[model samples]
Target: MEQVAEKLGRPDAGDAAMGKAWGIWYGSDSTAKRRDEIAIYSSYRDTSMRVKDVKQIRITSNAFKTQDGLATGANLEDTKLKFPDIKKLSSYLNEKKDTVVVYDAKKEGIGFEFLKGKSISLTVHPVNTAVNDTYLTLHPEWKLIN
Candidate 1:
């Protein structure tokens, strides 16, 4: 994709909606372990319209391979997964630097994530699914948009 997110990645900690589409972060590179998928409903991307396929979420990173972010010579410290904070998230979003969407965070779903450098567009239910219920981390910096 031409639009690559800059500040997003596997967060060490925090918190998506469904049918609508929201951003998500993960600590592990792959969704191998207890993968948690969240359904995105409404977001800055698709507005109030609810999408049909809530299972189309995608996750990736530049540090991985010939894809998103991992700049040349970037070490673990640079791409380390840290807990997310609402404030930090707002700051990142405010800067318009790290734009990403994590479509899944539910306890037993396939666990879909858009990573840091990419924006995920999916469908979600705004009334049923809550934003705070699925936070990226408990950290103060990982902010969630309501």
Candidate 2:
């Protein structure tokens, strides 16, 4: 945590808790706001939580791009062009009650979250592991997207 604070400057403490994961957020002040927010997650209160290793990094800005130029705000067609093997993984309603679609390129270890056909965020995970194999929060009511 100190190392991240050193490299990225200070981060705002995330107020919400999701299961056993704790989020540390950056760019959330009035100057940057939520649009430029980046969230880093760490295991919380579990036996393994003591390590505090980064479990997830959530990017909500287009300023950061993948080597192939994928970023937030990209449409499904554009994302498909960059990741031809990407497939609809699942769908869930966010806290806002808006439906979000998750697309995964399993071999690439990257997934894109789309809301209304536009990419809203991207998730990185271990290559070769399905999204279902990760620590991502799951909704019992999740809908499988074809």
Error at 86, model 1, angstroms = 23
CA lDDT of each candidate? 0.31, 0.70
Each prediction's TM-score against the native? 0.21, 0.72
Q: What tens-digit string does per-residue lDDT give for candidate 2 at 1-146? A: 55766877756656335443435454545665354667665555466645556655667788889998889999999998888999887788766677998888889888888998899887776688765565545334555544
Q: Write down the lDDT that model 2 would get.
A: 0.70
- The sequence of per-residue lDDT tens digits that candidate 1 reaches over residues 6-109 is 34443332234333334445535364443333222223335545333332232333233313343322332332322112111232232343443333323222
* lDDT measured at residue 73 in model 1 versus the true structure, 0 to 100: 28
lDDT measured at residue 5 in model 1 versus the true structure, 0 to 100: 25
The total number of steric clashes, by the backbone 3 Å criterion, in model 2 comes to: 0
| Backbone Cα, N, C clashes tallied per candidate | 56, 0
